[model samples]
Target: MRKLFVLLISIVVLSACAPVHRFTQLRKLPREYSENYSIEGIKAPRSAAHRKPWIVYSDRVENAAYVNPGGRVKSAEVGLLDTFLVIKTKGDYLRLIKYNPTNIKHNRLTQRKKAEYVGWMHRSRLILSPSSITDVQSGLHDKLLTAITDTTAIMQSATYFTTADSLKVFGDPELQNQTGVVGIHAIIYALKHSVDKRSVLVSKTPSLSADKIGEQVIGWVPAVMLQEIGHQVFTGTAFSRVPTLQKTLKYAPMIYPYHTDSTCSFVSGTLEPVIDKKDNHVFNINGKRISYTRGNQIKQELKRINILFAMEQSSRLPEQYPMLLNAIQNLGPFFAGSGESFSYQFGAAVATPRGMETIPLTADYEILIDRLVKMASYVADTENTPLPAWKAMRSALELIGNTPEAVNLIISVGETGEQQENAPSSIVKTLNEKNCRLLGWQLYASNDDKYNNYVLQLSNMIEHYAEYRTKNKRNMILYADQFCRSNLLREAGPNFLMLDYPYASMTQGGFLFPEKGETLPMELFAGAVDSIVTQIKADHQLLSESIDRAFATVGNGKDRLDSLLIATYHLPQGVKPNK
Candidate 1:
């Protein structure tokens, strides 16, 4: 009986041991398993296949990678400018594998405490290049450290690092001389600091030297030993572009089909009460403007206006053409009644024989729209993608003339990719010489990576151009998407603005109406559109009132017009005239 009991106990113990052994095997499996874990089936990002090296752009500890997507197990911590190779990507997450160039073997405690240095990080935490790191290291700022005393020993693990007197130290000190001068000072950048703020991991500056040693410099001294360096702060702001009443009407069809004539009349009278009527003529004293108070006699002033619409027109025109026509139709009454001749430039191509001549707004509204549509269509079909922006600017300037009488209002839609060729200084000089106030609109019609990059680059270019001069705030740019706004909006906030394209069904259908049964409320959409139009109309009327007062008080209509342009930019909420 006792023998039988022993056999049963043996079976039970073995069964328990078998499961534990399997569990141990499971634990030994690689952390980045393709078949299991949170990163299962997660492929690399479009750029990750290239295995590009990225550097940590931020200095915060939270900008770190983990063993898994669950983020429970932190494999390693990276400080500002620590670079690692991007091996894989899953949505916003990137798998970073940082190889410790300094590979020193350690025993027991020290080895176990060593950081893994290979894990998954978020894309936002990384910058594609190491320019910032290189700049700081090579800059005039001092970034070196020396042992405060001869007894100060180097450490192997930052976690267990100590500066106390001891017979034996858990680190290497080959770089330190008998005089306590550590030759690694200038080359050694303080890579990372410990949690207790007492120790730091030091490594050779990759930009300064080609030497990769087996032993990384350890931190046996407190952080106080390292000199503090201040970083240059750059603040940029992105201003939101409030659409004109005419621009808002372009999206009216998506809400519900409506005649352009009827909508124009409906919007012309619609006004939202904001500032007082007395406040409307504030621009007369500050800048030049047009007025209608002259009783049946229209003030005939030479007004130079140019519109540049540079879309990737080949593939985009089919979707955008109708809206463009609608917007132009709504703009007819405003520009036509202004008693000033206006010229319209369309597409990204060099001016054709017919396009070289300016199309006056005095032409019948319907005829004007038809001519524009046909012209834009021809230009898109004939010219290659992307309008040569600098050439186009020069062309517009030539058409408008550089004289003070020109007073050009150049509204540019989209920009070219040739940033260096179309330098900011050149653009600023061109605008100033032409007496032009530029208003740039960057369209983000798609989430395509290439398209997004193009728009962002365009935004940056506009910003650089705007920042190049402070004489006039009227030279501004508006972004179509929030992402672009967030990216560009910094300390220079006044120059950037968000131009909200209200038609969700057109731009963001997937996000707004995800399910088959989901339908947008047409009435609410129309109300929102009306609200926007009303506010825009009120702003437009205010500008008109200011112009009326300026022209009435008239010294030289041209000089007053110039001052009005400057005063218009200083409006409480500002205003964007119809394109």
Candidate 2:
């Protein structure tokens, strides 16, 4: 009876000891491997409500070497988090070993070769494609995802714990000598095993090999579990019983499993499929036992859950749908703003028999302007509205306006003589009457069939204004930019022209003399007139010289004149020539 009792006792003791032996012998993963492996947790520096505990681990020291290759060497002590495994080495600098659970398995380059190739090809296509703009947009999206994932991985592994606390937990004499993970590792191991009662699981089943079990855990388990374990290890007060923490009187691991289910619902539920009337028989069994159908469902669900969890943790997948939806929502007003700016800068016109015609205040131009005015009126309403497209268009327009060549192109288009007859008579009459305020008149003559005749008419109007309309001939001289000198000479005869030489007088006389009884301030009036004359001279010279230069460079002909006419008519700031 005694022998039998002893035998039973022996069996129980052996059974109790089996798990540790199995764990230690199972593959004997290097400490470095286990230490280096990690998973990203909640973002740091977050609000208390947003903060989450970080969790990381590795199967062997060598596995950890991939993150910090110098075989568990000590790195510089960081002020933020004390002792940590050195995972990266550069020059004399070392960084803590970090791991991203999502990319852990993806570390194999061969497996990702196809994806890498495709990505490279896609980028190349973007650069080489005809529609490079669209390609750039897509590439930006992809790049954003990649950057977010990479950044999240780095952030997750960084320790938030202090060095002093770590040293107290590790109790390594060398730590006092050098800032390193040697002490930190000892503490982590002690906390994990002794305090948390969370021994690394080892396979005892003969059929279930250690590698197979590790694979199962790594592949099938959700990353959130690691986080949970980490949380328990870091915050639990159970480790104070250990010799290292007992002396220091520091808090130990606070192993609470509450709210852990929130991280991974599928795992918490044990991968059980939702029960429905149609699938009820999946659980059916002979009256004695449940069958394997439900088990299969559970297994399948578990597999799916594992994959999704891994993907979520590893890739840092963006809330793409939400971001894109928000971006779209923000683009509406931008487009509206762009439309307004476009109409304002480039006067819209209606198609007419002669050609496309600018609408005077009463026509389609007026309607378009009204729409723009309305949009501008509501600028306060949509002041801060996000509209990337509108912003982009506005930027483009601004760029175009800044370039002299681009400005010239637009002016040429506006001045093209083919569209003159389409303008409102009020506008033409105002110009024909030589009114300085109605400066848009020059743009009308740009498209006329008899451009020279129009020019002659303009000169005649200016001459008439000089001779009869104003006593000092001030208005004609002030608005000299409105008349085409070459055209005037060709039609009205050079002898009939009285050029107001403002600069000649200024240079010849010590000061400009006021005419008798002038009380409106002759100096100010003369100064203004001189300025206008200077601008008119420069503009007329530019127009004639540009025409002459074009003829000299390209050969004198009607084509050169035509080109010059087009060029002059398209001046920026409208055809007023003030600019």
Candidate 2 ranges with C-alpha deviation above 4 Å: 1-346, 349-579
Off by over 4 Å in 1: 1-314, 337-367, 376-394, 402-407, 419-424, 439-579
Q: What lDDT does each candidate get?
A: 0.35, 0.23
Q: Candidate 2 residues 446-511, lDDT tens each?
A: 223544333343344334332332332221122244333221111112111223433221100011
In terms of TM-score, the best-performing candidate is 1
Clash count, predicted structure 2: 33
TM-score of each model, in listed order: 0.28, 0.15
Q: TM-score of the candidate numbered 1?
A: 0.28
Question: How many residue pairs in model 1 have overlapping backbones?
Answer: 24
lDDT of 1 by residue, 101-126 (tens): 34222211122123233677765454
Give residue 440's error in model 1 in angstroms.
3.9
